[model samples]
Target: MAKKAKKIDIRSDGREFDELREIKIQAGVLDQADGSARVDWGITMKRIAVSEKTYNKVESLREQFYIIPRGKGGKKYLVDVPAKLLDKIGDEFGDYEVVGEHFKGNVAIVAVHGPREPIPRHVADPYRAVLRFRYTMAPFSVPERKRPAPGRREIEISKVSREALQGVVFANEYPMTAIDIFAELLSADAGTRVTAITAASVALADAGIPMKDLVAAVAVGRAYGHLVADLTKFEEDAPDAVDFPMAVVPRTEEITLAQMDGRIAKKDLDELVELGIKKAKEISALQRQALKEKYQRVVENEQ
Candidate 1:
């Protein structure tokens, strides 16, 4: 059976936030990032972008041109894109000077942050730059919820999310610097992590950091035998559900990270994986198209 749409109280002025959720990019949200913008995910909101900087306006690194004096490291298609989408993205990257502004929204917001600052003294892990994830919920975001301090669960999720994000980020150039992403959930709906990743890449490009490709991700879930486009907290809490989250770079047809929590059978797992891959590819294609258009617009304006 098909599910009904969410209901809201109507007002003369119109229902509160009643409309199809859409993602749009507004320029110049932040100056620090080589590229930056604000993301409005239906009911949620976030501001994010990426920035790049030198190790030392001085050059005291253990190695020359090594941003940290040391460091080490680490997409998608469109139906509109040709069968040679991989070749196409590469061509675009090479021909383009700035790979800027990638943003999408759900019911919440997500922002991408930096590839700046030399490696922190604490993160002496020389082989790679650190990709960090943080999740903070505004006190008034939810109903009757007091502003509470961050708990262990949020911290754990942040670490795992970083793993998913870093899997795609090129940390070597930044070396000692940390790329810290702040995801403030003004009103979280679900699929926030995927949105975070989608936005983070745009910010990275704005920072003008070199990257091999663009990354895109999505979450597909099963509840009561029905599949959902993007899950929300309400659906996630349903009595019968299997939490499946997956991240992929569509252009490459590569699945970098996936996890299935809660109760799920093999058949359900297969379904989730299949659905996730399908949707992620679709989302990736849109990002590529949007980015190409965005890049072109920025260039035309410059000319």
Candidate 2:
């Protein structure tokens, strides 16, 4: 028996499925970081890339890079890329940088530090490099101050975020290393997780980490039985709402992260996942453009 889809009429800002709130992102906002990016969604800071001298010091960190797989047997193809080409695909880290608020208001910041040496030594794995994520909300991030500590929720989100981003990174390329990401919720909002993921991707690219593709994320929810994109804090709390956040490698359409609250039918889930992919691809394009613009500036400055 087939069940009919219910009509949903609720909306916070009358945004359609294909429409998202105003989005703005700028890279290299911070001069100190190896790479930084800022978005109206919030801010992000990154540290990556090394000087020719520094490269010599950490030269052992470099490893073979691969691209998107093709053909049936799934045998991966490797390419011989020079240093410039390494930068082209974000294989090599460049200067560190940071990004801050362009539009005021409270927004999250996603910060990444190091493809460098891993501290403590114990956490380092001999077989492959490791990636760790810490998701935190500041005391003043919300209307009411939160406890200044990493709670259970933060721990859970951090674990999930690491898992989500791990797939995109060439961890094996930096064996015995650690890539640490800190996503701070400076301005609390509904989709901070998604915002952090998007910002983090830009930071990684800015840092010049080798990657197959950039990651993009968005949250979708069912309000009044209708699907919507980029759920705000208000919409996320709506009664009976189904909130789902997802991260994807747009070019490959590979889902790296997905989290859902509230039950949904299999058919609805499929539809929402497709919708998420569409939105993520759009965001990914913007990410690529940001990197392109940043590098263009670097080239111009060098000249």
Candidate 3:
């Protein structure tokens, strides 16, 4: 667990500009991979490896964007550890909708694979498009962590993560092809899943998977009863925050994910969503800028 946030030095100007941290990109970090890059955005970082395999389902070649959803090779819905964590996530989220993309400082690596079997009909939900994610903490991600095992908090974040992302996927298109996005966290931040989802989208795109749009998330936390755009792990533990772990995608300019764990008035719901949507767009814009910069370098070097 982290401590609450303290003040930081703003620019010389009196304006309190939300200090944008550095986003460092290292390309081809994996020697054997067809495509791999490590994204270090401020406290957030993800090391993604992209490799391609032939698909027997030639019919699905039309999908230029795909999302590879994977878990810890098990069923997690309403299960043991995940459920308990979800309960706590609910407790924290009850107060406010922490909006934005990615975990605070989590690092993930994603890999893409081939056309697999379709999901069985029995387990599929009629109302929801399923997006699966597995979140783990490295043996040394945190200050006092080990064993490389996830705790209740990780499970809880996974549960809500699908909701944050379902609206952005086109699962019906490539019915059976599993876009496997595997993330091994070398570090833990508040926005790992959001980071993973962003990385997953890029990995899927690199794998030639198509989608309607790119989705991104950011977390907003309350401190001293004040709404902060992105909350660090330490600040999240602060009692002032009535909400925990909120993610939003800016594709439709509306909130697709909302969850809380503390006390808040019902009237505040719309306000929180509005704030979340607003910040999500800002984060999305930054992601697009990063993507543009990455691709531009590729083009320039090719020339």
Candidate 4:
């Protein structure tokens, strides 16, 4: 008799193999910039109620918890807690009520400066506008305070990001000019490059730059023996992890950016790329909705 196959366990965060993290995007967020957008891409861990006593002990660590009032007369203090500590406290604090939510994810803000004259006249292209992308992470963006300077990784990401969006843009319309995109990562967990690219696309559109389509991006890979979409840091650090990040132009189904880390079979690589394209289309829809909402807000304000 053939032996039954063992079932693979759910992801560490209890997500399906093809499930993406929750994403929230807002356009036209920066008043000074010609166009701007903010992308919050991450998962929300559970909210648990702890005694007022526990709250007091950790109250000084305000940065970590989001405090919410629960119960009648707002007597109970509920805090959105991180998942790392969830396993340690289990059942010891009595039956805690789920009252608040704690989000752990990446937050990126992108601003588009101009279709103005290029800074160095020599670098300007006579036939098409020059596209430039700058990607930076805040000092406090990671668990450890990252250095403020742009490192090699940042430079590489900026180069690839500029390449990714340059194709979709109708640069010929604004010759002898430069369109500059600045992407700042206020918080990061993983997939920072992809998040920045996604936000930059929206910021460009918000600036009224002509484009073939909004470029959408996502990271897909294999973790724990299963092909997955949107690998979290936990999955990215797995012993057998394979991370592949791709950006796509949804209208023509053209891949603008593709990068991979670690190894996988050819067949698996093909499957992963297909999964990335599928997820990119879903992200494209969200980008459109965010732009629509921004204009809707504008209309409401005018009235």
List the candidates' TM-scores in order.
0.63, 0.73, 0.61, 0.83
Question: Largest TM-score belongs to which candidate?
Answer: 4
Ranking by TM-score: 4, 2, 1, 3
Model 4 TM-score relative to the real fold: 0.83
lDDT of each: 0.51, 0.67, 0.47, 0.84
Name the regions of candidate 4 deviating beyond 4 angstroms: 1-8, 47-100
Q: Is candidate 3 or candidate 4 better by lDDT?
A: 4
Q: What lDDT tens digits, residue by residue, belong to model 3 across residues 142-215?
A: 66866755678677765665455556667666653443444456766455666665555555455444566656
Tens digit per residue, CA lDDT, model 2, 1-303: 222343544243334544655556666666666556665652121223334443443334222121111222222222222222234434333442111112222365666777768897889988778898888888987768899889888888888778888888888888899888777767765777887788778877887788888899888867555777877555565565688999998988999888998878899889999999999998888888987898798899999
Over 1-303, each residue of candidate 4 has an lDDT whose tens digit, in order, gives 112222345465556789889899999999999999999999877677767766665445332222232333266666654453455444434556776566778999999988987998888999999999999999998879899999999999999999999999999999999999999999998899999999999999999999999999999998777899998777787767788999999888899999999888899999998999999999999999999999799799999
Q: Total backbone clashes of model 4?
A: 0
Candidate 2 Cα deviation (angstroms), residue 170 = 0.9
**Worst lDDT window (10 residues) for model 1?**
73-82
Candidate 2 vs candidate 4: which has greater lDDT? 4
Q: Candidate 1, residues 1-303: lDDT per residue as tens digits?
A: 224332222211111211213554342356554555344543221111111232122133211110111221112111111112223232322222222222222433345556656344687457777777676666766657836688885676677667766766678866667776666665555666666666555555555656666566666665434554455444455445556667776767677667655666678677667777777776666555655665788899999
True-structure Cα RMSD, model 2 = 20.8
The TM-score between candidate 2 and the true structure equals: 0.73
- Which is the better candidate, 1 or 2, if ranked by TM-score? 2
The regions of model 1 sitting more than 4 angstroms off are 1-28, 42-113, 118-120, 146-148, 299-303
Best by lDDT: 4
RMSD of 1: 20.4
